[model samples]
Target: MSLTWRISLKSDEAEGPEDYFSSSLGIIFPDDITNQHGDAEHSLIYTSPHLSKSLLIDLADPVKEDDRKLFSHYLWNASLLLAEFVESDSLGVPLDNPRAAQESLSFDVKGLDTLELGAGTALPSIMGGLLGARRVVVTDYPAEPVLKTLRTNVVRNLQPAISPAGSSTTPADSVLVEGHSWGELEDSFSTTHRHSFDRIIVADCLWMPWQHANLHRSIAFFLREAADARCWVVAGFHTGREKMRSFYDADALREVGLEIEHVWERDCNGVERPWDTEREDDVTERKRWLVVAALKWIQIP
Candidate 1:
């Protein structure tokens, strides 16, 4: 027997202005099924009016099958979520060129040496590579299966070449995948790429209040030396207002010398709101909003 699931984009009837909204389609198997091998056996198909693509990811259980299963599940969920965001076209306004919310935040990516922290599935980093960035490094935690999956996605999605300005000149070559953790930022920076990236991009990385200090410290340590460095942290707040308050009060960002310059909201289409009055207590059904914060280093000139 096969199961089919649909993630609806329309939260309510009042439609907003965008042709398509981004969403992810997730597939899960019954827990009793122990023969599960990897993500490659499962097929994920993504379709939009403008873009349609299907990818098959393999799951290799080198040591523990259970670990592989858990990792695969997370990747599948993450990919679907990212797909929804990209398809919805509500990620953010294009700062430089017409690109996805993650890509657009990089301000054209042209000639910029960039790094994407906690880049699950590496969409923004891939976009940076597509946009002719001088060098694009996609980093996540040092988890084995996660890193493997990240590398696989990078190779699967890499374009033949990047045409800067859509010109016919030599195509730009950028490295795609790497590993770094907020906890290991100091060592990672000292060993590899050492004080390099001009722009650091982070999306949906501030969900957990506990990660604030380490994340801010990593950003500060790694990005402290760029001549004109900027860290763009984009967070989509679906958790709740209390978590947001906690995150703010942590002052992790202040300890690292970064300040939020502006806060704004973007109206997105295809978002769905459940009408389940009975499940009001369910945190998942609570109303959610998208929040963007533009951060820059405190200049003392």
Candidate 2:
């Protein structure tokens, strides 16, 4: 399903052009999964296209008054796209993005330490684990309700092979569910896991302009200081392209010693094209394209 929208920034000026800009961009989270089940607590079983194993992810109610708006409980389309790409890359299955300029895109996390930021349902992280990533750290906002759901998803899908961070018997490939608030530098998660991950996945996290700096900081700080280390980013334009463009064009990522290696536009149908800023912002068409990119740490002299 295409997560498309034309948001009106002003309450009183609803009749005017919907393009008027504002900080509070209306983000629509499309619940594309129809197989969701359970009454009191909802859950969905996801089966990857490339991988044989299936993941059972529990959904937390975000509308509850006291839950602090835990919207990360649901799986977004970008997450699924990223997961599909990674699984294809991991299994050496060639991606069928004919419109892509690079001809071929290479990504595989096998035997590497992987980390996922804003990992709501952790689909990508689960793919990394199943694909033989040396370690997979799944993290999200440090709230208990958010972390609880994240933990449940990770444990239920990857346990026996998964354990908490402090486990003495934790193996090299164990999936660890962690609580991480973006840009919290002095916290335990920051201190213990800095410059650690080889492969970092950031999915559907650039919607909030207010959180871009924090997200960039966390990405730069955690991504390993190596020539091969990369951060894979997948974001949708449901919040509006202008708001999404601000995060990339602000030079904030480059300022932090990270550089965009490559980026492309892939629609929901698995068709890919070169990233074009000059393209028309068709509200209906924009939802079909999800911007996918790879960022690597700048090598110092």
Candidate 1 Cα RMSD after full superposition onto the native fold (Å): 10.2
RMSD of each: 10.2, 9.6
Candidate 2 residue-wise lDDT, 57-89, digit = tens? 676555455554545765667886777677667
Query: Per-residue lDDT tens digits of candidate 1, residues 126-214?
Result: 55554456777777766676678678766765454332234221133457566676756446444666557777777666656677777
Q: What lDDT does model 2 reach?
A: 0.69
TM-score of each: 0.61, 0.78
As for candidate 2, its clashing pairs are: none
Top TM-score hit:
2
